[model samples]
Target chain A: MSAGMPFYVSPEQLMKDRADFARKGIARGRAVVVLQYDGGVAFVAENPSRALHKVSEIYDRIAFAAVGKYPEFENLRVAGVRYADLRGYSYDRSDVTARGLANAYAQTLGTVFTQESKPYEVELVVAEVGDTADGDQIYRLTYDGSVGDEHGYVAMGGGAEQIDAGLQQDWRPGMHLADALALAVRQLGADPAGGEPRTLTGDQLEVAVLDRNRPRRRFRRVQGELLTRLLSSEDPTADVPVPDEDDSPRASSTNPQTQRDSERDQDRDVDGGADA
Target chain B: MTAGPESGRLPSAYLVPGSSSFTEFLSAHAPALLPSRRPLPPQATLDAPHGTTIVTVTFRGGVVMAGDRRATMGNIIANRDMEKVFATDEYSLVGIAGTAGLAIELVRLFQVELEHYEKIEGTLMSLEGKANRLASMIRGNLGMAMQGLAVVPMFAGYDLIEDRGRIFSYDVTGGCYEEHDHHSVGSGSLFARGAMKKLYRRDQAAGDAVRVAVEALYDAADDDSATGGPDVGRRIWPTVGVVDAEGARFVTDDEVAGVVEAVIADRRDNPGGAR
Candidate 1:
């Protein structure tokens, strides 16, 4: 009439097992790519949901990108915003840096991994646009709380190794905004299993930038007609379309395919990737 | 600044999914950080410098806001060339009057609130929504307002949906009212409003609207001792901001000086503003 006693697991085994679980959950979702160009940093994610964003502005010059379970990463994103806002409020706006934010995320993720019954299945990238290309900084954080000071480009989530490989071969310093965006889209669409690469349209992809030349707030989304023109433009050095002086954020046009894909992804996120 | 938690993770209040307003977030997590939450001495009204005279005028495509460059204490001028007008965002501007210190703080918080909501929602708040948000923020300052440390701000923006410039004015109790074509606040507002009443015309050009604003400010300074007039010797001029379909920007010093010169030249001839 008694329950069976649980067997003890080694600390190393417990930690490794938690990491694998989190990795599997993250890998079930599509990937997000962050890269640096002459202008600033670009974040490209294969997200079809216009309402639920994968890339967001954290502060004046800093941006946040993530790939994993939507709710978990979204929680972290909101937390990061609060941290940055509070810090800026208390001290000066310049005091809130990506380094401090990354460290905070590292601490939070690390604690949740070690202490919680279930680890948060999320990966994040925080980028700060600098005055010069050399001054730009991009930090990548994994589910297990490890942080990587990435340069040039970094990829995360599903088929990240393959995307990272593609980026390593093609990404170069001082690329124009168009070139950087095209490269990111191309890498994100590349098939990881050695099949034909998918052609992602503007409606299927989410893109934003941390423009260095912009005034106080450097973070701006590149979408709608501007994104389409940039992708299809033949010349790499062509003048990118300048967004209208009207600062209103435009609603993205949705396609049937993207809508269907987003529905499926939403189901997967809610189910916690149990089927995968 | 609040000390970091021992675990180094953000406090639970931050992770709780809630309103996109930064001030709301502060009120929930760190109420002490809010300007209105601070406690003041009982029965004591702090004698703070008060900024004077802000005028706003709406033209065909956009709106113009101007403020005189003076802050006054009880009897003496506290500061000359004090900046009272600020671009709250790319498409909107705000000018503050009363209790210069608290007014500036309120402006800073309002700026953050708008930007924070935009970033979180991935969209700009409508002009009406922005004005309503400002009203709520002012309402939070009612405690401070009761003690004579009030802040009255005039907000003007280019409404994207309406495709025209709009103006909003507020009272100490946070009662927000939409003005038709023009509005003014501060100690010299009466004189400024009289000038605008005579000068404002329907569908005036942006350039004409700017001149009207400067003229109104000039009239205010001429009558009110607290309001500072154009200091030609020091080259200090009124701060002026214009918002249109393109965006909001501060008119250059040189450009404002040219308008001031024209106004002075005209005054020499008539000894009074145009009818």
Candidate 2:
């Protein structure tokens, strides 16, 4: 065998190999959640950096959230925003649609996957809010350019399977923003029981939404004290009985004092939440 | 697949990061898309009706802008009930004074420009930055201006940094200058400016400022045939907008009707208007 001569491989095997490589790379990143609720869609990512964001506003009614290589997804985010603005400028504001944006992204990703030596290790969700719940559209795009029209909720990145199962049990239509956000936080940080579940606080999570109630531009970031209030007021476990009596001493008394202490711990985690 | 211009796919210019200005991006990526990029014939003198008479005044809490409802072409009244004042953004107002069609188009594009900047940069442009952006847009229209379809606009905004209202006036060639107290533009600007010179004051109340703007437009309509005053029979009053630290808001017809009735009653008493 000559060292310079590449081994012959079937096209199917090559494509599968590239897809597996991209999937593995993406699985290493943290999870991101996109779900539908009353009045629009919400995105929650386990990210802490205020400067480098994984969830961003793409257009008036459209929002983009991605997980994978930071630089790669950030580049895609910029390009997506450019595409949206260009379309809105060329035609009309109402003409820019999430379907069109996802198609463009699919084309780009597909071309890169086939042409480049390595595939992009990224997953994207393009969501748009409409005049009514039936009109809301959510598109999930994978590294190999495959697209899925997810309904109700979509979860991706590390531990995505577990999060997806959890989301299936809790997600419902017409849930309030506070309830949906609390559920997302619980699903993202909850452990498999008999152990301490990971706690994701306000600053440790990047939260944004496409609020249909807003006029014109609908994308807005929810963070800081407001995020804290939303989490504490609608704690998903507030109504549930203690999970285990043996752990009551440690898990009990989520009183204002303990809540404040926990909030303080969360504040400390703000500086420690970087996952790059 | 070949990356041909006719392939109906996105041009690669979108994949790169350039200036945050949407106009600049359009110019670099698809030059044919920009409004300024369109070419006009050498002898193209637009015969379209032109809007006239806009008045703006600085008040104690904010700025007030008013425009009459009239369009004229070659001494003939082309249309009535034409609005020349527009809210460019949440805190800014733009009033067009010439070439009604092009001015409206420019205003709409300017609105998009501000929105695009905010979404891209994740922050609002400063009041001065917004004015400068408009100045450049007007400059781009210099070619059309030279062809006798000039567009002169008056811009007013609440300066959040300084916590006060400010106004900027432009010439046909895009020369921008800040106006103090009050300013006017359009064919009837001479008479309107004279009314403002007599009625405008420093730190007046918002209601008083509204009256002053309405009175100024009425005086302009009295002298210039192109400027139409409030038609009490049809209940058509001047369009008035107020820009404060809170934001820019257009005075509704109901509110303007009350102000117009008061102004007309006063004009009946003193047709010379505070002379």
What's the TM-score of chain B for every model shown?
A: 0.97, 0.94
Instruction: Give the candidate number with the greatest lDDT.
Output: 1
Q: How would you encode candidate 1's per-residue C-alpha lDDT over A1-276 as one tens digit per residue?
A: 236767889999999999999999999999999999888898999988889999999987799999999999999998888888889767667788999899889988988899999999999999998999888999999988899999999999999999999999999999888888889899989898999999999999999989886645677778887788788866443223344353431111011111112224534552212110
* Candidate 1 off by > 4 Å: A1-5, A233-276
lDDT of 1 by residue, B100-206 (tens): 98887788788778877887777888999999999998898888999999999999999999999999999999999999899999999999999999999999999
Those runs of model 2 whose alpha carbons end farther than 4 Å from true positions after fitting are: A1-5, A191-195, A234-276, B1-9
Expressed as tens digits, the lDDT of each residue in B21-65 for candidate 2 is 878877787778666777899986868889999999999979999
- Local error of candidate 1 at residue A58 (angstroms): 0.9
The prediction achieving the highest DockQ against the true structure is 1
Worst lDDT run of 10 residues, candidate 1 chain A, spans A251-260
Q: Model 2, A165-275: lDDT tens per residue?
A: 999999999987788888899888976443677889998999988877654567778877667777797444321111212111111111111211222353465221211
Q: Using Cα atoms with residue i matched to residue i, what is each candidate's TM-score against the true structure? A: 0.91, 0.87
TM-score, chain A, per candidate? 0.86, 0.82
